[model samples]
Target: MNAAQIHPLARSPLQSGIGASEPDPDAIVASGVHVIDVETRALQALRPRIGAAFVAACRRMLECRGRVVCTGMGKSGHIARKVAATLASTGTPSFYVHPGEASHGDLGMITDIDVVLALSNSGETEELLTIVPVLKRQGTALIAMTGRPESTLATLADLHLDVSVPEEACPLGLAPTSSTTAALVMGDALAIALLDARGFTSEDFARSHPAGSLGRRLLLHIADIMHSGDGIPRVGADATLSEALVEMSRKRLGMTAVVDDDDRLLGVFTDGDLRRALDEGTDDVRTTPVLASMGRNPKTIGADKLAIEAAHLMEEFKINALIVVDAQQRVVGALNIHDLLRARVV
Candidate 1:
């Protein structure tokens, strides 16, 4: 572009601090503060505008049997993509389709049962306007978000959400700043509103994000990771301490459950208990009964509890392992801190 086309704020290489004096720190801070203040005001202005039109837009999306197709051009397109992701992850099915691509056959991705949410700061984005006629013919619902209520795109929309901003944060008044922030915040409001209306819970959100930390905490149960069957270290209450140590070594869980003939848990014999016995010098491992050194009423968890709950219990008690018991207090499984770490639940 020529010099006339260049933005007033654009600086040539030589003017951009190549061996030039350092910029004033106070000026830089003031500029940042001004930008934040402008965006904050934009959001404040957007709040009251979420009335009838916003409600109608949300209603259209919620009733959509297909999906919410978000479309826009330029910087507005970036906001549309993010809004689409937020809507999708928060329970509403949505996706972003670039306006330019929509005009080039990507519009086929949209169906009549779907709602199209189009964004344009000026409400005159050519690419978005070009596809409106086709969308209209297809009987698709249109929700327009723009700064100008009188613009052609707004006039054609079934619902118009006014995102008018008082002023842009950019000093040059050419770049999208406060306008984009208003659009993004408005999108979030719609998504979260629909999320609540749909009774979307954290577990529902976790189902969509199974690979994330929140998913691991909410969906991973103790039974999913606990070692059951032969993996559980256990010995009869009548067994010697030496036999208990052998079970603990073979299972490698740092502990063995002392059980009765019916396999009902009596107590747990851990490495810590053995160390305490050695320090006290009271009994020999080869001759002493496992019950003598075992800790009674040890911390136990149900196999159905969330893995995160186990972590909390372990941290609260300062223990490294826990015996998994069933509803009848029978030893069913075992797990350690390392198992939780391996599952990335901690």
Candidate 2:
């Protein structure tokens, strides 16, 4: 078959303009590089523009008796929402309110004590413009983030933050490309500056994100999820395999901590060890002492350690369970993979 017949789906099956040649791989990569370079330059240019107005915006947020109400339209609205989230998580109380929604009685959410941060690339978005008068009537402070400092919104605002970029990264220069990036970066700068001024600690961040993985790492302690006292499945070192197996089966943790008479863990015996024993052709498995079959110096974690640290220990050692020890290295509790999963720390 000819090449045209074999590749009927080819762009230029007929060698006409019906299908143009494929875009060059280098050109595709260069296009992305160009966009990034443009956005990088835009952010660099914005650095010099950070002056008194930006500091005043942060001071207003810090002084507000109410929340920071961030409102915007279109792509600017998306950036507004992210900015609000960053602010809220970094010790500043903030939330996003769609400008269109604000015109329809949602405006009540903004009070005199609140500071309204309005975002618009052109500073002339009709939805944002419609609510500016109402915000003024309510005696609420206004902060404007826009590419046009001379626009009506900027003129009406108590503080105007100039976010003008050299040009849009979009080839047509119509899409909100570098402009939106500039706004987002400025929002992040404000949030981080406020974070530093407020002395936001990691613990404060964990509280704001209590359901996230970082929260689990920072807030969940081993003691919070471990099985203590009677809940632990422990067998004496001198106990027979049958007794240890019974303990494991009763606890259903797939393993048993082998301990001494003083309740100090001596070692551990798991299903894997049992399998190894059976493969070694040991006769009368029930008669074997747990001490003879147990693994010596098994890995353990302290009760005061983070549960995520315990998870890392389990993964690094390729084990399913760990004995929880006190500061003195005496076993006080026990936990397994299921415990970590239940605590949402895995």
Candidate 3:
């Protein structure tokens, strides 16, 4: 890999503080690149011969009504687990089933509606074949991924996806490296193809992953956990600063919504404002109206937006809170960084 060439505007040996004894940058980059070269060679090896077989594999997964049961042995098992996760996180519902365990009665996990994605570089794994007959009897479709097109696993599969590589990236030729990476990428390709075919939106992905940041971004709606009704700390803009401070403390959101008589969002008065006001050496409870210290035009977001969008907006503006407003600019609810954190949006 070539190192990024420095531009004339940014080039200067003085910018580099490395001592003269430091190793040559070319050798340093090449040392790391040699490993990448091996992996690249393997992926390049998969690019060819991906004709009808890849299409068959995708069709098998697309026709699947039940979850995709991924099974494999050894390092292939590790790769299978990741493929299963990718499938599940995308559109396809999937879970990893250990082949060894499947032989020990876990084969019961395979249902008639499910589709099997079996992995084995050699196209043969004794533990995997043990349950193959049962899967066949149960009417479950099988999709095989292997380096050998003529192997038993491929022969038994309803659809065979050839993931052959000329050689392993491992120096010993014993470890599974490039082959496994190819399998992983192939699995990802299948998953994304299915995701696109099914019109799997990020919102759908978030529903499947309600615990992750993606889930928070997609599944969360303002109406689901917004500070609404009376829990919303709100006060009229003409209210005294003392009144606003009481509302902020009582609401415990570190901020108070400053609204007009018609509930239109006039501005916002947060703890930061209070601090700044007090630091200006004014008495904490002087006759200053809440409107006097509030932001004239506060940033706002819609209630239906993904929480990730809200976080991005807040981050870009260097603000901590955002008021949820309607089409008419009426304040419906409000939230801050901590709310997003608690909701796992961050």
Q: Which structure among the candidates has the greatest lDDT?
A: 1
Per-residue lDDT tens digits for candidate 3, residues 190-223, read 8888899999997798788888777777788766
Write candidate 1's Cα lDDT for 1-346 as tens digits: 4754333234543543334588645445656776887799889988888798888888899899999999999999999999999999999999999999888889899999999999999999999999999999999999999999999999999999999999888868879999999999999999999999999999999999999999999999999999999999999988998999999999999999999888889999999999998888955789988888899989999999999999999999999999999988899999999999999998
Q: Which residue ranges in model 2 land beyond 4 Å of their true spot?
A: 1-27, 228-231, 260-262, 271-288, 292-296, 316-318, 326-331, 341-344
Question: Highest TM-score, which number?
Answer: 1
If candidate 3 were superposed on the true structure by all CA atoms, what would the RMSD be? 8.3
Task: Report, for every candidate in turn, its global Cα lDDT versus the true structure.
Answer: 0.92, 0.89, 0.83
Winner on TM-score (2 vs 3): 2
Name the runs in model 1 displaced over 4 angstroms. 1-19
For model 1 the TM-score comes to 0.94
The TM-scores of all predictions, comma-separated, are 0.94, 0.82, 0.77
Rank by lDDT, descending?
A: 1, 2, 3
